[model samples]
Target: MYRKMVLIRRFEEMAGKQYMQASIGGFCHLYIGQEAVAVGIISALRPDDYVMGTYREHGQILAVGSDPKAIMAELFGRETGISRGKGGSMHLFDRERNFMGGDGIVGGGLPIATGVGLAIRYRGGDQVCVCFFGDGAVNEGAFHEALNMAALWKLPVIFVCENNLYGMGTQVTRASAVPDLNRRVSGYGMESAHVDGMDLLAIRALSDDVVAECRAGRGPWFIEAKTYRYRGHSMADPATYRTKDEVEEWRVRDPISIYEKQLLGAGLITDEEIRGISAEIDAVVDESVKFAEESPFPQADALYDHVYASGE
Candidate 1:
């Protein structure tokens, strides 16, 4: 789990640098410090199980098993992207892998996941659908509607809210009436819990339990993973809303580093194994960058293609 989290953290770091260099175009959001939440939750799900998330979803896609090259290419807006360069950073989709997509609208994926759960229930498929979102999205109409329907129907959808303390520049307290975001889910009669997002083992354990419950037809669980992002909401913002002290405080509790310590202390992983995994992730990300650079952009006439299928 530590190695996996490290991979995500490093991948996001590289992606951020690439975005700054203008190599990667379109909207880019970094999941630099909040790696454990995605890695732990996705690790608990099966390959056939569906996964969905918001724009800050590179980690989610990779953790759920999307090809690194394809995702990087998507960021570069190349034709070889997962969504054929149509979705860019926010709309990564791979139906073959059961990763529905990374939606752009706040809480937009919730309704989609609810529908997926409905399909699974209707077809008697035991596959669970895990939907990821930010704390900011909890206030959206789609969030309320989806949760209400899922709870009413007892849909097997695990709502994993990555509460990174802020929604863009807005703080959770300012945006939400209730700061205990997980508890708020209970208003719709859904079982929910708040987990330490920086601790990978904690997240993995909780997710495993919740996913198992959902698989057994005991569903509609909401998990608020308390996390923190190292970077500003986006590249454009200077992050003046939050102080340096706040950023440093979260950095001290970085999920990747903290999990590495725990794993090392628990004898779950050795230092050499950790270093080797880091090197591997570095190589893969570098390869992805090179692949993105060498990939061809979409043709001019191809713009009208894939908009709507023609009778021809």
Candidate 2:
């Protein structure tokens, strides 16, 4: 778990650097502080369980076991990318890992997740679909619609809201009529709960119980993970809306640091071991960048490919 979080942190840091260096084109959304939310929830799931995420999804994809090299290549617009360089940062997909993909539009993954749940039910499969989105998405009509249908059919889906206080520059309090997002689940008659996203263990424990229940047919649960993003919404934004003091306050409860403290307190790991893990992850991130740098770009002739399904 610690290694996974470190991998995401390191990967995002390198990705941000690449984006600024113009090696990675398009909008790049770094998943810096909200590592625990993705690591915790995805780690507790079965390998076959489906996972969907929003545009800010590098961490989510990584947590589901996607290759770091392929993800980095995708961000670099290389042919060896997971999406063959077409999807870029916001549209990462790994079908073989049951990582459906990341959607660019806010709340776009909601309805798709509902459909996945419906498919699972129709196929009489026990697999659950964990769909992740931000706080801003809850206000979208698609959110209500998707949840309503999922609740109605009792779909095996866990809708996780990564409530990171701000949806871009706008604060949740200003945008949401009810700041307590889990309470909004009352309308759909779905089960809901809140968890501290910085506490990876707590999130993992909650995920295990909820995923089991959902797979057992008492499903379509909602989880509001109270998390904070240390960086701006995207590479373009300066995040001038929030004060430096507020950011520092959240940093004190940094997910990686909090988890490290817990592990040390429990005598589960040593400082030396932590340093070793960090070194290993650093090497991995460095290699991913190298792989992306060496990989080829997609050819112009291939543009029409994968555009439509073949009749044969």
Candidate 3:
């Protein structure tokens, strides 16, 4: 579990540096410190289950087993990208992996996941849909509308709120009236839970029960994972809105460090194994960068290929 989270952290760290060096273009949101939330949630999902998420989705997409090469290529806007270079960093879609996409709009993925849930229920499939959004998105109209429909129709959907404190520059407390996200969903009469987003094992354990309930046709479930981001909203952000003391406070609870210690202390893994795994992932990430560099950009004529529906 910690292995996967470690991989995510490294990948994002590399991505942020790459963005600074102009290796990756367009919008790049790094899930640097929130690895536990993605690893814990995605580990609980089945291969056929759909995952919808916001722009800060590299970890979510990679955790669901998307090829790092293709994801990096997508960020580079290459023809070989997961979305064929049409969607860039904010729009990676893989139907085979059941990863719906990384939506640009803050709350966009919620409605998309709700619809996916409705379709799964209508088609009589056991597949559930997991939607990931930021604490900022909780105030969006789409959140309220999607939750209402999912609750009313009893759709098999897991709405995950990755509350990393700030929505761009505004703190969640400043934007949200209630601030208690789990309680916010209660008004829709939906089941909700709050998890320590830094605890990978705890998140995994809770996801097991929540996913079980959803798969058993128990309508919708909302999880508010309280975590923090090490980076600003994007590569361009200076992050002057928050204090160093606050960031340092959250760093003490860094998910990857916390989990690695537990795994080593409990004899689940040796320090040697951890180093080996780290080396392997670093090599893999290097390969992804190489592939993205070698991949060609999308041809101008092909620009309209995926963006526009043929019939439309």
By TM-score, the best candidate is 2
**Among all candidates shown, the one with the greatest lDDT:** 2
Per-residue accuracy of model 1 over 77-159 as CA lDDT, tens digit each = 99888888888988889888898888889889999999999999999989999999998999999999999999999999999
Could you give candidate 3's per-residue lDDT for residues 165-284 as a string of tens digits? 999999988999999987889999999999999999899999999999999999699999999999999998989999999999999999988998998889999989999999999998
Each candidate's TM vs. the true structure? 0.97, 0.99, 0.97
Ranking by TM-score: 2, 3, 1
**Model 3 residue 196 distance off true place after TM-score fit, in angstroms:** 0.6
Give the CA lDDT, 0 to 100, for residue 153 in model 1.
Answer: 99
Clashes of each: 0, 0, 0
lDDT of 2 by residue, 153-204 (tens): 9999999999999999999999989888777798899999999999999999
Alpha-carbon local distance difference test for all models: 0.89, 0.95, 0.91
| TM-score, model 3 to reference | 0.97
Error of 3 at 309 (Å): 4.2
Every model's Cα RMSD, please? 1.3, 1.0, 1.2
